[model samples]
Target: MANDKNNGQDNLRNAKASASNMYEEGKAGASKMYEEGKASASNMYDEGKDRVNQVYEQGKEKAEEIYKQTKEKASEIYEESMKKVSEAQENLKEYSDELVKTVKEKPLTSLLIAGGIGFIISALLKK
Candidate 1:
């Protein structure tokens, strides 16, 4: 009975040691898995940030290009409008000068024309 008790004690000790070793191995494996998962998450976050930055840069460049084009078109339109206004002013001046010359060259004709225009206007106003 003494020898049997000693064998039983030795068996119990071996089982405890085996259980401890298994526990340590499981803890190590869990720690390694946690580290790997953290590293993967960090890498994914960096990649996403880089992609967003690239998209932002592309948008900025496109916006600048559009702004430049719009400004150039506006300038062209403004210059064209100014040119047309200048031409209209010159034509009006030429017409006024011609009318003055005609009035000076033929005083009787201009007087008759003026009287006729006045009579027509008065007739229209009466209606």
Candidate 2:
């Protein structure tokens, strides 16, 4: 009976040592997993930040290009409008000169034509 009792005590001690070893191994595995997860999260965050920066640069470049194109087009349109205004002014001056010459050559006829135009405009305004 003493021998059996000793054997039971030895079995209990072996079981306790095995349980302790398994507990230590579980802690080590959990620590390794935690480190791995942290590293993965850090790497993902860096990659995402880089992508955002890259997209921002691309958008900025595109907007600048669009602004340049719009400015160039506006400049061209302004120049064209100025040229047309200058031509219209020159033509109006020439017409006025011709009209003045005609009036000088035929003063009575010009006066009669002006009276007729004024009468027609006044009649229209009354209506």
RMSD of each: 2.9, 1.8
lDDT of 2: 0.99
What lDDT score goes with residue 87 in model 2?
Answer: 100
lDDT of 1 by residue, 18-72 (tens): 9999999999999999999999999999999999999999999999999999999
What is the C-alpha lDDT profile of model 2 across 1-127, one tens digit per residue? 9999999999999999999999999999999999999999999999999999999999999999999999999999999999999999999999999999999999999999999999999999999
Model 2 spans with C-alpha error above 4 angstroms: none
TM-score, cand. 1: 0.76
Q: Give the range where candidate 2 is weakest over 10 consecutive residues by summed lDDT.
A: 14-23
Off by more than 4 A, model 1 = 106-127
TM for candidate 2 is 0.86
**lDDT of candidate model 1 versus the reference:** 0.99
lDDT of each: 0.99, 0.99
TM-score, one value per model: 0.76, 0.86
